[model samples]
Target: MELERAVGTYLRHVALERGLSEHTVAAYRRDLDVYVEWLRARGIVDAEAVTPELVADFGAERASAEPPPAASSLARMQSSVRGLHRFLVREGRAETDPSGRLRPPKTPRRLPKALTIAQVDDLLDAAGPAPGSEDASAAQPASVRDRALLELLYATGARVSEIVQLDVDDVAQGDLLRVRGKGDKERVVPVGSYARAALDAYLTRVRPALAAKGRATPRLFLGVRGAPLSRQSTWLIIQAAAEGAGLTAHVSPHTLRHSFATHLLQGGADVRVVQELLGHASVATTQIYTHVSVDALRDVYATSHPRAR
Candidate 1:
């Protein structure tokens, strides 16, 4: 069958019979379109003429090509082609699926970077402004907002999005915060005394001045125009704070989250409980930090023991 005709049939099957999402169908279409272009350039007109050897050759070509695709991208292409061939086989249009044995190129998983507890303390303390100097007015410095944000983020293990979107009502005394995570799921997390103090200062002094330009919008963290802070802005805030903290550690908002989880685990919190606190869908997702902790122990054993190598 012609590539065009077979692809049309496959798409109809995907959309109507299999009920695949539009985004997924679009990705499959893109992958198959590339295949069709390759076939046309080589003067190959029929799907039945395709072979596993040819498919394997194409995989190799893509792997060695300059600006080669990442494993995730290659995996998506393989999935799309495999699905198409499977469809053709089910209809008895092809003897076998040429794309069945394709494998994606390997991609190394990057470890999450975490801040040490002392480094975290230094970063948070360094977040606010330098006192006894600078600026025109008697207003509070911008770091007041950033200090509260970083403190709250570390204290509650709240996502940057959640922190930026939080309101005055979200915080309560006793160092507890009511955090709404992804998919509107809510969990109560303890905000350390430091976070509470930063929050108190911001609410009492800094936030009011920042919100002086407009009516209260119920967002605790407000921009100059009194709107709720955006996630991007929140990230920029963390990045700026990381720089100002003066120790060169490649830090991001997630680094604090990882630190929170690792510190909790190091202090003997159960892995399963950490999963629940982080709002992870499964315990497996939270197990990576345990691997980090284990590696640390091994390093200590290797270095400190007299007979260890």
Candidate 2:
């Protein structure tokens, strides 16, 4: 079968039948498009013409390009190519899966960047009303909501998607938050007192005001128009708070999450407990924070230890 036609079929299958998200489908399309172009350049336009060596060469070429793709991008590209070949074999369009032996580029495991406790405090303070504001009523509802959102993110270590997907009823007794994580997995995480207080203020004072601007929705966080807050908006909230705190560095929602895990580990929390709290599928995934804690310990030891340097 023609490579382009097979690629189109596979993309459609993944989108309509396999039920992949639009973002995922787009990524597959992009990666496959590049793969197909490379194959065409090599005079191997038929799906059956694709070979293991050809795919490996393509990866090597991409890796050797000026300002070569990062390990993560290379891995993603390789995955996309492998998936296409697998689909071709499964559908009998190709005699065999040429990408079966393909290996993703090894990516260095970078430690998660976490804010110091003082820096986090500064960020949270910036998210709230300025120090010594005489009347809380003077604060915009959106400002109040942003503070609550930031607090909830740091407190629960919930992904931005999970936090924004929260419904009004998700907060249970004992300051517990019912979070729906990746793959629709639900886990209950406790909200710290600070987060709970912020949530109460937002729910009682600000959320209703935002909700009144449009029809009611079950979504916990809303924009000024009462529409559910988007992932992009949540990112912008973090960025704004970081800027307000005079933090020139990039700040993402994941930064709060990294800080949450690292701080917990520094406080001597177990990795297993953190895995459960962060909704990580494996303890191995949560173990990265241990490295962060160790790095911090080393830094302290280097600074404070009496050993000869």
lDDT of 2 by residue, 47-109 (tens): 888888998898889889889888998899999898888988888778899888888988999
> Residues 1-309, candidate 1, lDDT per residue (tens digit)?
887899999998987776664556778899889887876787777999888987887778777778978878887887777888899999998888998789876667656678889899888766774222242134355777777788888877767767776778889545778877665677888777777877877787778878887776888898777778887787787777777778687778888899999988888899998888887878988898887787678877999999996
Clashing pairs in 1: none
- Rate residue 108 of model 2 by lDDT: 94
Which parts of model 1 have CA positions greater than 4 angstroms off? Answer: 1-66, 72-106, 129-139, 214-216, 299-309
What would the TM-score be for candidate 2 when compared with the true structure?
0.85
Off by over 4 Å in 2: 1-25, 40-46, 90-93, 130-135, 172-174, 295-309
TM-score to native of every candidate shown:
0.65, 0.85
Cα displacement (angstroms), candidate 1, residue 169, comes to 1.9
